[model samples]
Target: MSLENTRHPAGPGLDELVPSRYALRVGDIDVLVVSDGILSLPTKMLAHDADPAVRAAWLKDMFLPPEMVDWALNVVVVRSGDRTILVDAGWGADPNLPRAGRLAQRLEAAGIDLGSVTDVVLTHMHMDHIGGLLVDGIKDRLRPDLRIHVAAAEVEFWASPDFSRTSMPPGFPDALRTAAKRFLNEYRSQLRLFEEKCEVAPGVVATRTGGHTPGHSVVRLASGGDRLTFAGDAVFTVGFEHPDWHNGFEHFPEESARVRVRLLRELAETGELLVATHMPFPSVGHVAVAGDVFRWIPAIWDY
Candidate 1:
């Protein structure tokens, strides 16, 4: 059948009118799961080397649409002691994604004043992760005392000449490079780079987990013996079932898979709260070992 003549089933229509905020207390800290919006990509964009039939069957078995993959754009806000820290800014104001760019609004809904954010911790420099730092290329200087913390390796990778000339899919490298440059230039004065396992806040530390990018890191929040790991993009919901599957957006698929598997195992073993950036809205969960693989056990909803 001709591609145009083929009739593929459709999934549910996009829902953008739902509440995008959730909150929970960890010991003395208040962690808020703030939603920026949803991101939709074609399923073919994942597991590129896997057989198409197998991929379709996997999605079908999961009762998900075989054609598209939907991920939430969730960021975390931690109120520890007298400090308010934001983990990864969402896409600020992108005309292309109307549903997104709601971080500012959601923050307000959660009773958080943008001006009160004292620290911003970045898991990586991926556009979605850092785009919300600026709206229309203008840094949100609402917090005059704002300090932006990022992985030193991440900064170095994006700033390297090699990264600039690296070949990428059409219409990708240019935009990514441009944003990287803009982010660095705008936040130069406030940017604080750190090595592996450096604390970005009182109880928050950046753990080196590069692979998605040259310097992707995961932020861990520990308080009163309770722990939560904000696994930037180390693994998505689907990735729990297939830890070896590599997403197309990863810089180094092999390394990304390796890091993902290791992290999943550790999280599962410890039963720590796992907050994924691309899981369902308010993406807070725990990893459990299911046979030889890992499973995502969503956190109990308090509301």
Candidate 2:
């Protein structure tokens, strides 16, 4: 239901109107899943190559609307030892996506101060992943010495980016390019470019798995006997069942599919907790091997 039509107790802040964050632990690390808000987009973007009938059936089975969908935007905060790391900033202010760009306010509501963050591990340079840092005065709030970790290949790719395969709505290509360029130009001095992987904290490592983008990466957290993965945009709600489906926004659809399958297989084999950028709120779940396809087993809320 639309928020306008749905009833709720009076509240001034968005976080109070509805839940915006979830806290959990991984070995010795603390993780908080925060909502940047949501994006409403055409359902065709979900799988541009799928047969209309098949895609329709899948959406119907999932109980999602056939024409449009509200995609969740989740940003993760990881705290380990003396460092607090931000994983993928949300779209700070996209004129087209008014519902999103709530990460700054949401982070504050979650008690995560911007200046307190020591590092940022980016999965890619997608607008939704880096636009929050570009928000007005965001740089002032962040410590000048903050380290931003991202794949060197990702930086290189955006410099001469190609969008021959994507099937986005009008204006998205230009918007994405502009946002990525602006972010890099603004944060070039703070970037800690890595070729393959980099240890962001005591227990967090971001590994490049070029598929969705040349520099797309996933962060893995391990400590003691517990493990979790912040998959960024590498995984999604529909990825488990249709790993081969080409998301319209994927730069390399085939490679993205391969990466998705491989990641799903590894997560299933290891039985690690998985959190992704576009899954439902508090996207904490486990991957399971269900015959030939994978299944998403959401974790029971600790509360």
Candidate 3:
């Protein structure tokens, strides 16, 4: 699949609509990469105990430019037999965040509408990923018909009355308290939680991969002997380069590392395409195990 960005009225200070990236098809599923803009952060901000040489090597390997790293929010849309499943909603219209709020238009560009989405698979409840779930009209609001699929632990944690006020770890912000609270308040009733591993549908299975959040998950799509995994935040930017690097945004840093290490090994050993929400554009690639380390080999497609 190819991405084409058409011009649309800027939401606030933006000049034009941003383009999207497409990962084409995997057997019966069509994966559309929707761009929700990007976030710029310093390398050190990702990890507190970063080793200088390892960090530099990771940056070099990923072809990351110096100074800052900009991560694009790549939302995944899966069109299988009869399912129009959206992996995660992008950040919605926020005046302060001009780069975001383009998922709706991007979806239209990919020939999809909010109403056409049959199921929503939320990996976790991060602001940038879940902000677009609600229709934010200036005065009135519109809610789409979507049966949200989430990890039972995640739903329970975020929906708990005390979750919002609970203090987060060092790297996390207090404002996450408020945002998560709002998300739960608005969508709790609409959410359907699943256990460790379950078939969300015919060929779509929800895999248990946590640590980024209490109940973060990765999705597996299998058809005709082919499989693809939609990994939410299981792996971060540095992890793409240095699989050992632990991202600070994780709810449980050590647990996240353990899961990623094992998951990456399995993915490489299987030689299947993996889609990440923040692993460059299109974010679909295969893993190559090099001795004890791993490399991300991006899928080639005609633009």
Best by lDDT: 2
Overall lDDT per candidate, in order of appearance: 0.78, 0.89, 0.71
Runs of candidate 3 exceeding 4 Å displacement: 1-19, 60-66, 138-145, 159-172
lDDT of 2 by residue, 1-303 (tens): 112211232235634667888888888788888899999989999999999999999999999999999999999988899999999998898676788999988776665679999999999999989989999999999999999999999999999899999999998999899999999889999999999989998989999999999999999999999999999888878888898899989999999999999999999999999999999998999999977699999999886
- The weakest ten consecutive residues by lDDT in model 1 span 1-10
Provide TM-scores for the models.
0.89, 0.95, 0.85
lDDT, model 1, position 230: 92
Q: Per-residue lDDT for 1-303 in model 3, tens only?
A: 222332342245434433464656666666677787776666664554578676777677668765677777888877776777888887777786576667876666555556667788888887777888754651122235567888888877665423332233454465455567777788778788888976766788887787777788998988877889888888765675556566756667777778888888899988888888777777778998777677888888656
Q: Which stretches of candidate 2 lie over 4 Å from their true place?
A: 1-14
Poorest stretch of ten by lDDT in candidate 3: 1-10
Best-to-worst ranking by TM-score: 2, 1, 3
Q: Name the best candidate (by TM-score).
A: 2
Per-residue accuracy of model 1 over 1-303 as CA lDDT, tens digit each: 111111221223322347677777776777888789987777866676567898888889878798777768999988887788899998778787787878876665555667888899889987888888768633554676688888888999887524331234466667777778988998888888888877766788888898888779998888888889999989886688787776767878888889999998999888889887888887888988877688888888885
Query: What lDDT, from 0 to 1, does candidate 2 have?
Result: 0.89
Give the true-structure RMSD of model 3: 4.3
Assess candidate 3 and give its TM-score to the true structure.
0.85
State the displacement of the C-alpha of residue 271, model 3, in Å, after optimal TM-score superposition: 0.7
lDDT of 3: 0.71
- Total clashing pairs for each candidate: 0, 0, 1
